[model samples]
Target: MAAKTVTIESKDYVFNTLKEAQNYYDAIVKELYNAKLTLTTGQDFEDLKWIYSTYCHYTKQNLDKLSNSDITGFKGISTVREKGGQYIPTECCAIIFSDSSSNCTEEEFFTDKALKEIAIKQNPR
Candidate 1:
């Protein structure tokens, strides 16, 4: 048996010359590289969502109770909105990255204790 070779050609090729085809191929390669560069992992995505929600809640509460100057002085704050909404703070990142200065704030610790006490009184536990 003899080896056979076949060649295929498009009569109406969009790119008339090999250089044009190469240019198109190069453009597609660049686009693919750029797209890959922008991808993020699932865990990173979820953490971002949680950070956004927490920041939104804190910013809303803090801003409502303080003046603009006072609000700006605090770090790691951004615009706050209902759980699902569109709004971005002009001057802050939508996430906070910090450690607790205390294990829990004085007010929150007492409030949590009070709630636990009430729960215990309601049902013996």
Candidate 2:
């Protein structure tokens, strides 16, 4: 399908799919790490690249497997909706974010094996 041109909040941004928008965002991150964000360099820069690249590599693959419809997370409803804020797509807010839908504050998604690992760490055999 052809990507539609769109403008929001006095800014013209066009992205056909979530993947396209993500690639654009990732490019910006690369600019920040290697160039624009001047402060950290060498290992810190490499580490940041590694961390975000790994996240992008795997998630992008997973995202490719899903239909665009499924990616429209929460579809038009959000409890913590911010007024007058740049609307972040579901793709942008997937991981590293907490919301009413996927609240992982307590690490509730950890498996039973993780509990055992924590116990062993606290009380080693």
Candidate 3:
């Protein structure tokens, strides 16, 4: 198949054709390739992968916190209205991904910690 032959223009650079744009990017990558991996041995690569994985997980959580309806926004904790019309905190552990957008019990998480917080919230002294 023939490649697109249209010219591409960005801020200050104009690429005559798709191949030219690709070659331009390829050249930039080649120029920086050695510098990017010069100090990275197998162990260094593994460490970077580990750190990147953690970074992705951490950022996803933080981003979730910024949203009102994200599970991590409340750390998978929620509330349920009981038969008596009273409400109770519920923990979903790692199952739910987005916040239910309902009220979550105050600072209640893990069972023990959550129970304490629930008690404190219910009967503050």
After the best TM-score superposition of candidate 2, give how far the Cα of residue 106 lies from its true spot, in angstroms. 22
Give every collision pair in model 3. Answer: 70-99, 71-98, 71-99
lDDT of 2 by residue, 30-51 (tens): 4443442432345433333333
Q: Which run of 10 residues does model 1 get worst, by summed lDDT?
A: 104-113
**lDDT (tens digit, per residue) of candidate 1 on 40-91:** 3343333323333333343354433222211111122223333348654322
How would you encode candidate 3's per-residue C-alpha lDDT over 1-125 as one tens digit per residue?
A: 43333222122233444555445433433333333322223432332223223333433543444345422221233345354777774432222233565644223223222223322333334
Those runs of model 1 whose alpha carbons end farther than 4 Å from true positions after fitting are 1-14, 37-125
Sorted by lDDT (best first), the order is 3, 2, 1
Model 1 steric clash total: 0
Among these predictions, the greatest lDDT belongs to: 3
lDDT of 3: 0.33
For every model shown, the clashing-pair count is 0, 0, 3
C-alpha TM-scores of all predictions: 0.20, 0.24, 0.24
lDDT score for candidate 1 against the true structure: 0.28
Ranking by TM-score: 2, 3, 1
